[model samples]
Target: MEANRVDHLLLHFFVIVVGLTAILGKLIELPADQLVAWRTLAAAVVMGLVFYRVRFFRQPRKVILSYLGAGGVLGLHWLALYGAIKVSNVTVAVAGLSSAALFTALVEPVITGRRHSKLEVAIGGVVMIGLGLIVGFASEFGLGLVLGVTSALLAAIFPSMNKRFVDQGGNPLVITFHEMVGAFVVCAAVVLGRGEPVHMPTASDWLWLGVLVVLCTVFAFWMHTWLLRRMSAYTAALALSFEPVYAMVLAALFFGEHKMFSPWFYLGVVIIVLANWCYPVARKRQAMRQSAE
Candidate 1:
């Protein structure tokens, strides 16, 4: 972590930004799909400029197309996430989104042709237990819960695909640019199909969307891609586990009345987060023991 200190800081910062993205999204008051379209478009332009300036934009055409596919999935992921918030409250949305790690645990091995680590599986189970407490005991049974779970599932697919895409030498900025553009395209189609009025933002709305694009999406995506280059998928996922916890805190600050939960809420979230944190450590020890044997 020390050797890659910059990467670590960036990853944590990315999580913080990602956590607050929901709060910012809520403030915009646009339909989930429309909001995401604008976000994708804004983020794409920001990332495109970065890619163009940095000389890191080069990638093969096939790889670029692969990233476009990944971006399509990403577009869906954002919709599901925002939809979860619209259908339910942030607590349920955050809880459901927390399951991304669980999905990654199951998907990484199958997608990457690697055997599932026992430690990752065990830790993932514990996190699920914590989430179950958040859901079954603390949250109401409702459509929000269902949407949240769906959001998690969508969240899982894109990141896993991203790991694979990058592993195949895909350019991170290019991939992000293509993906954001793809998301924007898909979102535009969706908005058109529904005949929804695309609300032009007021002053405050523009300010919030600016934060969403610059801090949350652009900077966060750059950090995420940078981390992917420096860290193992499990390490990255473990770090990402902190995101929902951060989101919950931000949710409390912004939407306090709506987000207030029982004491069990914090306890349960802590358990889930700690379990995720332990996964990398546990995996390291296991590998060390096998080597010693």
Candidate 2:
């Protein structure tokens, strides 16, 4: 029981760190593609150093290639997220991420070849309703909302893909490292193809990027993969639903994102948050009744 409590605490902390990605994405004055490229490169370099002794080559070629593909998708996910932030404000970008839970519900079963949970589908519907409300109020940020939703879809895909690889006995850290490499390669190609010069970061940008790569990407992602070994992906998705809450509060505090939305928009956010919070409880009760029967 005590261990469970500690794990939950750590999980929330992980979400908080993940929440800061948007803030860092906004603070770094680079295009989304370039930012993702550099961040992934930094993470790959750090992770490589940390796990230098591990023989990643010993892994089958198939596994290595899978991680690379997933990493490419993950890079696209980050690009969409930062792109949203650049086109809109932090609040809209983060709020749109809340839709990831809905996407996961829709995508996971398809990927895993499992039956879809009716309750999850219903909950996803509720989440979509909430998102529709937010988008309705913030129509000016339409492009941002679309990009953010696209990121959510990719977010669902990569994690579900990772879960499959991990089930096949892939080391979480190694998968993460390779994924970073894949992201770096893909982003670099995209940036170069666009005819964009890679801009060097200022000292302050370096500091922020360091925090983002080390704390947010590396640590948070490692912890997420670790936790997935013990918990259902549904539980993890529920917890991640709070990420928008954390990001929104931080954005308000740091970037004055509070002024960007109306009370109705906040109402929509509250509805989405409440649905996530209640889902686990509802699932637990259903399980209890099934056991009793």
Candidate 3:
């Protein structure tokens, strides 16, 4: 952890920005699909200027399609996440999303052909338990919880696949650029097919969308890609487990969401966050045991 102090700090900052997405999502009036479509479309448009000089067409066709496919997964993930938010509050949506750490423990091994880490899997279970405690047996959040977990599944997958791509010498910025374009296409198609009204954003919506595109999508997307170069996908996903904490806190501040939970909420928050912070220790012990054996 000390060795990668900078990466850890940057990851926290990224989580903060990601948490803000829920706040913005709640603020925006568009349906979930439309919000995702607009965000992806606007992000691609802005990011094009950054990588326009690159010869994307000359790049490998298979690589382009692969990144695009991953981006499609990303599009669906965002929609599910925002859908959860629309159906329920930010706490319910984010708490369910925290399970991505566990899903990554399961998925990353299968996707990357890596051996499963018992410690990581165990930590992932703890994350799920913590999430359950936070959400409790509240039947009201059932649909939202389901969608949030679905979001977690997709969220775990693409980053692992993207890490494989990045390791195979894919340029992170270019990959993100292609993926955003792909997300926009997938989301736009869905929006059009649903016959949802695609009216232009009003002034307030534009302000929120602008913040979302420039900060949350463009800057955050690039930063996420950059972080991948320095860390494993599982580590990244584990760190993201802390997203709910930031989101819960932000929701409290912005939406007065604190009163909605029981006393178990604080305990659950502590447990989930401790799971993330425990990663470095768990990883070191796993390596030591492996080497000794």
Instruction: Identify the leading candidate in terms of TM-score.
Output: 2
Deviation of model 3 at 93, angstroms = 0.7
Local accuracy of candidate 1 as per-residue lDDT tens digits, 214-276? 888887776687677776566667677787788877787778833457777667788888897
Q: What is the TM-score of each candidate against the true structure?
A: 0.91, 0.96, 0.95
- Number of backbone collisions per candidate: 0, 0, 0
When summed lDDT is taken over every stretch of 10 residues in candidate 3, the lowest stretch is 1-10
lDDT for 202 in candidate 3 is 77
Top candidate on lDDT is 3
The total number of steric clashes, by the backbone 3 Å criterion, in model 2 comes to 0
**Winner of 2 and 3 under TM-score:** 2
Model 2, CA-based lDDT: 0.86
Local accuracy of candidate 3 as per-residue lDDT tens digits, 1-293: 13288888998899899999999999998889999999999898888776688665567889999989999999999999999999998988988899999999999989888899888899999998887886674457989889999999999998998878877888877888888988988899889999967877778989999999999988997888788888888988988888888998999999998888777876777898999888889788878988999
Tens digit of per-residue lDDT, candidate 2, span 1-293: 12276787888898899999999998999899999999999999998888899776678888899999999999999989999999997889877888888888888888766678888888878888889899999999999999988988888888778767766778889889989999999999999999977899889889999999999999989888877666656556768778888999999999998997899898888989999877878888888999999
In angstroms, the error of model 2 at 98 is: 0.8
Q: After superposition, how far is residue 127 of candidate 1 from its true place, in Å?
A: 1.1
Give candidate 2's error at residue 18 in angstroms: 0.4
